[model samples]
Target: MSASPLLDQLIEALRCLPGVGQKSAQRMAYHLLERDREGGVRLAARLAEAMEKIGHCERCRDFSEVPVCPLCASPARETQLLCVVETPADRLAIELATGYRGLYFVLQGRLSPLDGIGPRELGLDLLAARLAAGDVGELIIATNPTVEGEATAHYLAQLARQHGVRPSRLAHGLPLGGELEYIDRGTLAHAFGSRSEIPS
Candidate 1:
């Protein structure tokens, strides 16, 4: 028998999200319809509101419906030291660790040439402009240690040199190919404490 259009529509729409396959989508749709209509509507409404309002920070490229994120808005966030990350999730991880009092620059993505994400697409030019502003004294490259992460770090290091800013990278203590989101708070703190200067 054919599924009704409304149920199928939500399942199909949710499947567009990463890793939510047709099976999981069907399960979610059923749960929403059968068990949790109020919860489902709430989730859908909140998702819509956030998607419509949240946007990128013009300065550091983090999430900000406003002109700047709350962190960037704070004058006490040690703007002299900027930590570069690949996504907002990394920011949450670093925030959880709490040793990093610096501002952040989210690349928004990595160097995926196959995916057509180049330096320009990753906001490297805007980063270059920010570095040239002379407000920052140090740059911490906190991209994960995957192949793409390493490439992104290398690219940022080169750009940092061009702008005459000191750049550093987290020490290789975390496991290879591991994400910051998975690393524990203590380890992340230690990594921040022992960051090494990027060679010129």
Candidate 2:
């Protein structure tokens, strides 16, 4: 049972997205062909356009349509405080928590030595330089509670000490190895409120 050439190609491409299996891709592909042909074209066009237009922020490496992201570019956001996390979604979680009013620096990914993601890959060197230049006051580590996340946080805390600055990791309560994106607002807020310094 083979799909038509065009349908098979569509299915293959869409399946590249996370959580989208062959069945889901086939369903979506048929839906696009039968009902949303123009809509599908528009979606593809918009995706391409956004990819071309958006780049990483100069300051925090968050996705940006401009050189700097909205939060980093805005003058009103607190410049002294910094929240470091693995992805933009993690940043969104802190925003949802509603307690952190400061700016953020997104690592885009966390350190995993087994996976070959190291300090240079995570941009800790860049962060160290930024803090040393007196660009921030306190660095709040909001990375997830997974093994790699904890490793990354510990590494950053140690790096900050060499620069004579202190770093703090979020307090326990996020469920061991849990991600920020899935946490509820109350729990996230409590984590932020009760954050403890990563011991030197």
Report lDDT per candidate. 0.89, 0.86
| 6-88 per-residue lDDT for model 1 (tens digits) | 77788889998899998999998888889999999899899999999999989889888898888989988888999999999
How would you encode candidate 2's per-residue C-alpha lDDT over 6-94 as one tens digit per residue?
A: 77888999988999999999899889989999999999999999979988897898889888788888888888888999999999888
Which parts of model 1 have CA positions greater than 4 angstroms off?
Answer: 1-3, 174-200
Tell me the lDDT of candidate 1.
0.89
RMSD of each: 6.7, 6.6
Which pairs in model 1 have colliding backbones?
A: none
* Lowest lDDT block of 10, candidate 1: 1-10
Colliding residue pairs in candidate 2: none
lDDT of 2 at 180: 93
* Model 2 deviation from native, Cα RMSD in Å: 6.6
